[model samples]
Target: MAFSPEKSNFRSPLKGPPSPSWNDLLLKNKKALNHVLFTMHLQSRSNKQTPSSSPSPQIRKSLDFTLPSLVSDPISLLSDQILLSILSKLPDSQRNCNSLVSKRWLNLQGRLVRSIKLLDWDFLVSGRLFVRFPNLIHVDLVNGSLISLGECGCF
Candidate 1:
């Protein structure tokens, strides 16, 4: 007994007409298949050579070119009010370090100060204390020299 495609009642699962044997199909499209294979071989050879070859000036320039960074300062993105709110939640000891970050951070942190202990009446007289902390509601002048406050003319 021998197996044969023609003698069997098997139908192709594919949608098109039943396929012939591999030998018949290969014989029919041998020239077309050879052309396709030759083109593919040439393309693969060209691809293999490309990486070894020096790129053109235009291509080299394009490869060397870099785009500007999209990343920005995360602190700069937050609104002043939000930054102040965050600064206000910090502990008194940790709050001192926030001023060292940047001028913007210092300004934001200053706005969060509701009470300040005055060490020098000169600073208060110079008006820089009020300028730095515009939101201050309480000022502790106990540490300052008592005579300086009366002479400062801040009354």
Candidate 2:
């Protein structure tokens, strides 16, 4: 029997590097990596012991109040449901100021706001210029502000 390397040992030249599929490895290790990252973030946050090094200016402000009695309680901003209910009842002309307070308020899906009145020319111009809502059927403009509904492609 002749010692033939090809016959005695089977090795594919095409298999020179065993490339493990990348997605399989990532999916397997996802939970472990997330845990490590979360733990490291918490550890770094806890290691900063001084208030001077605290990241939140709001927390620092709260600590600086010398007169505890004088410090006013922060008014609870209305929840979206309450704001929506209030918005439903309030006249159309009054909605913008309250809506302007927070992005969440701004994001109250506009179908909930049926009527919009533009009392201020700037507010009307800006609303006509930018805002889009499917359900807005009526817009009353005062202060000589006018929007050409014909010019606007919106139907």
lDDT of 1 by residue, 54-145 (tens): 55778645532321122133235456886787778678788889788999888878888889899888998899998999999999998865
Q: Which ranges of candidate 2 are over 4 A from the true structure?
A: 1-78, 115-155
- Residue 38 C-alpha lDDT in model 2: 45
TM-score of each: 0.48, 0.26
- lDDT score of residue 127 within candidate 1: 92
Residue pairs clashing, model 1: none
Tell how far residue 78 is off in model 1, in angstroms. Answer: 1.1
Q: lDDT by residue for model 2 over 30-148, one digit each (tens)?
A: 66644444454445555776756665767545543432333232122234575577566655565666567666656564646656675557655566423645467777665346556
Model 2: lDDT equals 0.55
- CA lDDT, every model vs. true structure: 0.69, 0.55
